[model samples]
Target: MNVVTRSAGIFLLAMAAIALPGCRPASQPSGQIITLRLSGWQSNPNEKQRLDYLLRKFEKTHPTIQVKYETINSEYMDVIKTRLIGDVAPDVFYLDGFEAPLLMQYQVLEPLDRYITPEFNLADFEPSLLNAFRYRNQLYGLPKDFSTLALIYNKQALAAAGITHPPKTWAAFTVAARKLTVDRNGDGKIDQYGFGIAPELARQTFMIKAFGGQLVDQNGFATFAAPNSLRGLELIVNQYRRDRTAAQPTDVGATWGSEMLGQGKAAMVIEGPWSIPYFKETFPALEFGTAEVPAINGKPGTMAYTVAYVMNRKTRHKEAAWKLIAYLTGKEGMKAWADQGLALPARRSVLGELGYDKNTLYAPFVAGARYATIWQAGKHLPTIRMNFNNQFISALLGEQPLSDAMQRAQDTANREISWAN
Candidate 1:
């Protein structure tokens, strides 16, 4: 027999040794219950509670299987990679689009196409989200959730500045930002800046593409330093340094863009749906509005982030793992999870059922989904991201010219990628 057949036979034997026939599902051999391991990071305590509740419901339906869920709070990717190399990784785990390419390329994830059934309605998922987890025509993951950036503005702040609506174009946005900036007490230091900025590759990537620039060339080497890309990036640097109307989180003693906006440190921020619930819970009285990100170079653009449930290739209980993946990513399950409004559902039906597209608070995010750039480049993205962020901040601080900073970053990232290859 072939290696695959032999492995299947051994897996059956192992199951037979542990499974109890009486409780086994109708299709599988009678055996004792199987326990599957799952790992992921929790964004908040409520998210963990919601997942635990869902897992309980899943268990009630599939009595023959049990899932042990674990949370990796820090350095999640590093920990997962170590566990994978040691052959002790969870049967299934969360995979971000940014990290999917590397694991998919390494052959560490199981191709999920074989397990997908017509009844599962794989076509219900958003094509862009699904494409993030595909590698070489094989589906390695099923996107569980996604989010796209939108311009989140404080209503009172906008009105105070005499702006009746959010800016629709880059030129207008800059003007609005300058108008909103104020030194309320004549203390020489601005009390409320017009915009809060995030100086990271993930947020700036869409800007790079706004002017027909690419993040990586055909060979997956860094190309973000090209002239066209710099033009878009220069807009951000100028807003912060020359216009002096934008501030990074550090400038306002905030940890992130959401916090910067929430505390009234800034009037606007580019964030995703996750900020909706955050504002309601943490800043309940803060009146806010959402709008599609301003057009750059006469083109609408924003960033989309997604995560998927991927099974480990070496999982011994392939059948059980597949069942769990299908259940979690299924329409019913997705709706339950997305009802929290923390993230957008990946399935078109679930998103529609949730009414996010029609809800004024969430419509901008939903609209941007149609054209947002998926936040992924290649397997070397982590390396490229680190180099870009380090130098990009230097440029934003005026320590170096934007062009020189980007050039240094590009050269350093490509050098590191070459060494790895």
Candidate 2:
């Protein structure tokens, strides 16, 4: 029997035995409780509190199971890898899409297909998010939540600049950005830039894809130095260097793109739904709005980041661990979790149930989910990302041409990947 069926049968038999006058079921381990260790990095205190509440609720429904949740704040993936090597990893844990390929490749994660019941409604999840955890045609994880990029612009700045609406295409966006940039007080220094950008690969990968650029070939070698990739990359470089309408967070003394927009150092940024509550709390009076990330070459594109609940292959209690994963990623639990709006629900039904598609600020992010490039490449992505970020920033700062920077990044990344293999 499948784990789900067996578990249900055991529960039903135990209930039947309890109904009899003095009969105790031999199959039931008298008052035996299984404790599951769960690990994830905490984004904030509220997220931790909310998860604790959800765990309590799950324990109530599955009375025999208790979950001990741990937060590994720093060096999360490094800690997880070490624990996996030591066989001391949590029974169930969070796995980011970017990191999933390596874990799945190493065969350290349990294939969840057998444990999944039809009633689990696996199809309810967004296919792209689910595909992130699949390897060799087998599934390994269930996405807990996700976020997609969108254009977040200052509403007041647009109006003041006589732009009635947010730009719908890259060309229009460039024009709008030029108009929005300002240098007040005749200081010769720009007081506000039109756009704030993160030059890291995570944010720029979509740009690579925007113009027929591929991050990796079928053989998983870095190919981002190809001419097509540079075409898209040069747009960013030109905007920051030639146009002078874009600035990085450090240039304006801010820490990230969202902070730059919030601080009025930039009039626009491409960000995700997490920035909504952040703006409301940090910049309460900032008039902001969101739109689908401006189309590139008449094609819409964005990036999606998702994290999943995956079972450790070595867990003693596979069934129990799956029960926790199921309940947490299930419709009810997901709805409750997503109600906090920390991230978008991975389940399509839960997203609709929460009415995120109707919310003005979140609708663009929701729309982008359909076409967003999942922020996952092959197993060598971490190495590729590191080299790309280091070199891409140099190009953005005008140290060298975009072509040279990308070629150097690609060559270095491929050498490391080849050595590792």
Question: Candidate 2: global Cα-lDDT?
Answer: 0.89
In model 2, the runs with Cα more than 4 Å from the true position are: 1-30
Tens digits of per-residue lDDT, candidate 2, 287-365, equal 9999999999889999999999999887878888888999999998999888977799999999999999998989999
| RMSD in angstroms between candidate 2 and the native structure over all alpha carbons | 9.6
Cα deviation at 34, candidate 2, in Å, is: 1.3
* Candidate 2 lowest-lDDT run of ten: 17-26
The lDDT of each candidate is: 0.90, 0.89
Cα deviation of 67, candidate 2, in Å: 0.6
Model 1's number of clashes is: 6
Q: Give the lowest summed-lDDT range of ten residues in model 1.
A: 17-26
